[model samples]
Target: MTALAPSPTLSETTRTTPGAGWLLRLHRPALYLWIGAVAVLAVVLLWLGGPLTDSAATAWREYDKSCDTGGSCRYDQDSIVRYKDVYAYTTAALTALPFVVAAWAGAALFGRELEHGTAQLAWTQNLSPTRWLTTKLIVPAVLVTAGTGLLVALHRVMWTAGDGRIDTADAWYANLTLHANGPTTVAFALTGLAGGALAGVLLRRTLPALTLALACVAALRFLADQLMPHLWPAVTQVTSLADGYRGSGLNVDSGLVTATGAHIADPGCGSTIVAGCKTVYADLDATGFYTTYHPESHYWPLQLTTTALVLAVAAALAVTAFVLLKRSTAAPARVRTEAAA
Candidate 1:
């Protein structure tokens, strides 16, 4: 007679399995939401790169030929207006994605499990707390990185296509435009994942963890914006009054340079005669002007440097989360050992 095969035990199955099937199942809703968002954003970006760009170019040509010439122009004002609004919103959506990641990670991925004893239950069922947290961090980190990276690429493509054509397009250094259109977006997404996981692990309460994680992500973004200009050294050039201040990229500062090499504010006297400001202009010695700016070449360097800094912060947060998990999981064993002793 053939013996009946024994069923696999829960611990045996868990140990043998390589993926977070249960966790994925638990947050299936979030996954679907992310997919939906990416789809919508992708469609919008393609629109921006194609039809909207052409419409915007046409409107810009019309405006330049007539309105800019101090005459009336029959431009398709609605199309241009729509293009600008949509582009602004698209960039805003990409910029705001990190906060969404933080919220989901804190409330759904970590905090919910900790709050309801789910994570502890998993630990009892042959999964270690470290593995549980690692899975949480790794899975979301990968997803966030992939999603944001794709969006960044799309944003770059759209921006390149619209450059010099769309009159309302933002300068490359505009805070939202810069962050949304480069690798910094991916960096911010990863930072959000790490920060949210840490916050959730520390708070272990869904609502508060969610709120704090979003706040933390916002703070990180703000800090990044504050430090971005300093990431790369700026270039300063003095130009004659005839040339005017026409430097591009990230304009740091522009001021009048006196003949004595001292910097002074522009006297607002550009080819226009101002009687009251004669003495001021003479003392200003505005033979020429200086523009302090990060030229176009500095764009990639600034983006990469900021990305590295943000990644370092993410690494630190990940390490802290691991440490917190270890301490939280080990406390009970330590207490029992002391009681036994």
Candidate 2:
């Protein structure tokens, strides 16, 4: 009679485990830390939209009435000051969250595994190098994406509520506000994860990977800030000195256009008759001034475009990491084959 196939063993089954449960289990501490940060930010946002907003409104009203009555405005100053401080902190926390995510990903996720012998052990046990790298990337990506998306929702709510209410609230186009208040927040978080993973794979050392990953994140952020305004076309508004233009959102540039069609910088001119205003205008043959800016309507287009750019970079880094892993894994097998021959 033909013999039956041998039964699979526990080690073989564990080696073929296809889920990310083991990866998540290994990085549970970092996951907890991320959750805790999200919790703190959630509470801060709740406070900002609720109690802080209410108190700021009261303080603003009191201060307004005091100005109307020509009385002192110091009574509610404490509340105003406190609200501003808290709002600043909230914005800062939102801006810094991505860096924190990158640090953890670099130091704890792939870095530690490669620094120790655990990665090779896992490979020997049954895990393919590709699957190992994919798990490290995909598991943290899901967690970071979820956490950051929630914070973005809450921040959007807070930002909307602060409109025309909180005196010290940030402008919608302010650098930190623009980034922290949009989908770029989530996009950048994912970018951070991919960047960290790439750095870890390259460095293969925990501390070095952590430092390089953070540096890459900072450089990427700076480039984004510089390129954000140019992602979409800006509207140009030209008018005579009598009827000037005013708008919200990003202000790209403002200057005077001379009669000779030459553009000249604003001379800090408060009036036509100001000390150097007339002279400068005459020299430049100034006729009127023009302002180019992004209106509020451009917010979504700008944000989506920026998100796309960041995601593209993240994808490139991820592809590079996978390619490197494949090469590294293949070299060892080739070496072993040569030795056997």
Candidate 2 wrongly placed segments (more than 4 Å): 1-18, 72-75, 242-245, 267-270
Lowest summed-lDDT stretch of 10 residues in model 1? Answer: 4-13
TM-score of 1: 0.88
Residue 229 in candidate 1 has what lDDT? Answer: 84
lDDT of 2 by residue, 1-341 (tens): 66644434435444656457667556666766789999999999988878877888888888777876888755577777877888788888888988887887788777877898677777777688898888888888888888888888888888888779866778889988898889898888888888888888888899988887788789889988889889999998777754544555798888888787766787767446456667766777888788889988999999999999999988998999899888888999889889999
**TM-score, cand. 2:** 0.91
Clashing pairs in 1: none
Candidate number with greatest TM-score: 2
lDDT of each: 0.83, 0.81
Deviation of model 1 at 126, angstroms: 1.3
lDDT of candidate 2? 0.81
lDDT of 1: 0.83
> Which pairs of residues clash in candidate 2, taking residues 3 or more apart in a chain or in different chains?
none
Q: Which run of 10 residues does model 2 get worst, by summed lDDT? A: 4-13
